[model samples]
Target: MQNQLIAFEGFDRVLNYGLDRLRCPSPVGVDRRIRLTQKVASIEHINATMFRVVLDSAIWIEDEDKPAIIASLIAQLHAAPDTT
Candidate 1:
């Protein structure tokens, strides 16, 4: 993965984005959003099945919204083939 600095809610961390999925810095404390999507079954079924979008834990920490953006990007990439 590349060392790409992505800004979160108020923090910054290196986020790695791949063709199929994204690896986001894990959320700290009693987190719920990013932490909950650790499971394949936890993400939206469409994204999981079609785009194979995934969210996994990492050594870094950041805001939860970053993953949502990643997922959107992945879906757009996945859909690009038929659109253009």
Candidate 2:
């Protein structure tokens, strides 16, 4: 049912951010229940079937370092997981 609903969890967090029910981007539906302990931000649910997740804060890399840092992140995303 997870692929049906919407949720995001990572980095030692049991549940970081998610929508209990998709309610079409409204003040009545938007809520922030997750608390992050590091540089990651909680997901922002914008609509009934839409979400925004910011993986990292700007603290890790400077303005000039963003290119390299972004490239590294992209490579990791496209890279295969390690079994060993």
Candidate 3:
């Protein structure tokens, strides 16, 4: 995963992007918005039913809107076409 510092939620957050599905730990914590389909590199695999998206625990503890984030994630995952 490549780490890049991006401004989010009025703070500089270290956002990791690449093929890795795991969210990298950042000092400022991760925002749930960054975990969307565009940012998640393994999204195609997940959408194809080849695997699943794993979220780091920090998101649960840090993101203020975890429930909605989780819900959106789940909906996106389930909305994918079943390849298996």
Candidate 4:
């Protein structure tokens, strides 16, 4: 099995980049299984009102559904409210 992970700072950029990366279809000639996991977190700066966004993803290579799964996770995170 293989795993792939990613992190992003901006909400919009995270979504855009995640989707673009997921556009590639078919992990051909690969025998290993793949898994994907994504997470988003926000933190507030002590001196600033703006919140920082963190996007994380874990995936395994050769997983056929990894792209769609990761994309969905990213979308959900983007839709979530900013806690910070």
Candidate 5:
């Protein structure tokens, strides 16, 4: 199945902001960005073949932060138990 999708689960306030940012550049509080990056890496995928892309809202992450966050998420995805 090549059709893959990404999903996020977390506190409503945070998820709302994260989703919004993913859609477009939007303002987010520092605390929210910190929380998002911390949780982004822990995503467990139900399907193992698809690479999960969890991006932090563009408001806070700049320079090295973006790459670090992405790398962390990829690491977590690889470490996740294969469910498929």
Candidate 6:
């Protein structure tokens, strides 16, 4: 299985995106929004400091699309800094 790792400044944003996409309700969303997706399977850090988001099971993401999804997330995260 492949793992995707990401990081962000704020934790709330990351949590929200992950919960929303993963279709899992979490209490953490109520407090602070995660900024990014951090470690994956506690193996790779992805050099992230803010938030850690990982799409492990196939339920969360398709095996074929994993790479694309990861790339997109990374691109979006990098673009965010420029937009703001």
Q: Each candidate: what lDDT?
A: 0.33, 0.29, 0.31, 0.41, 0.33, 0.31
Residues 1-84, candidate 3, lDDT per residue (tens digit)? Answer: 112321123222222232323443343344434433223322334433334443332233335444222211211233334457
Tens digit of per-residue lDDT, candidate 6, span 1-84: 222333454333443333323433222323332323333342233444343344333222222222222221221122123333
lDDT of 1 by residue, 8-65 (tens): 2322222333434444443345554332223232333344213333444233335544
Question: How far out, in Å, is residue 84 in model 4?
Answer: 27
Model 4 local distance difference test score? 0.41
Q: Candidate 2 regions off by >4 Å?
A: 1-39, 57-84
Q: In candidate 3, list every pair of residues with a backbone clash.
A: none
Candidate 2 backbone collisions, by pair = none
Question: Which residue window of length 10 is worst by lDDT in model 2?
Answer: 68-77
Model 6 score (lDDT):
0.31
Q: Tell me the tens digit of each residue's lDDT in model 5 across 1-84.
A: 101234433312222213322342343445453223333434444354323444432223343343222222232232334557
**lDDT score, residue 35, model 1?**
26
Models, CA RMSD each: 13.3, 17.6, 14.2, 9.5, 12.7, 13.6
Error of 2 at 64 (Å): 17
Best candidate, lDDT: 4
Which ten contiguous residues of candidate 4 have the minimum total lDDT?
68-77
In Å, residue 8's CA in model 5 sits off its true spot by 19
TM-score of each: 0.19, 0.23, 0.18, 0.27, 0.20, 0.19
**Which candidate, 1 or 2, would have the higher lDDT against the true structure?**
1
lDDT of 4 by residue, 1-84 (tens): 112455443444322323323343444344666566666643433232333334444454653544423332323223234577
What is the TM-score of candidate 6? 0.19
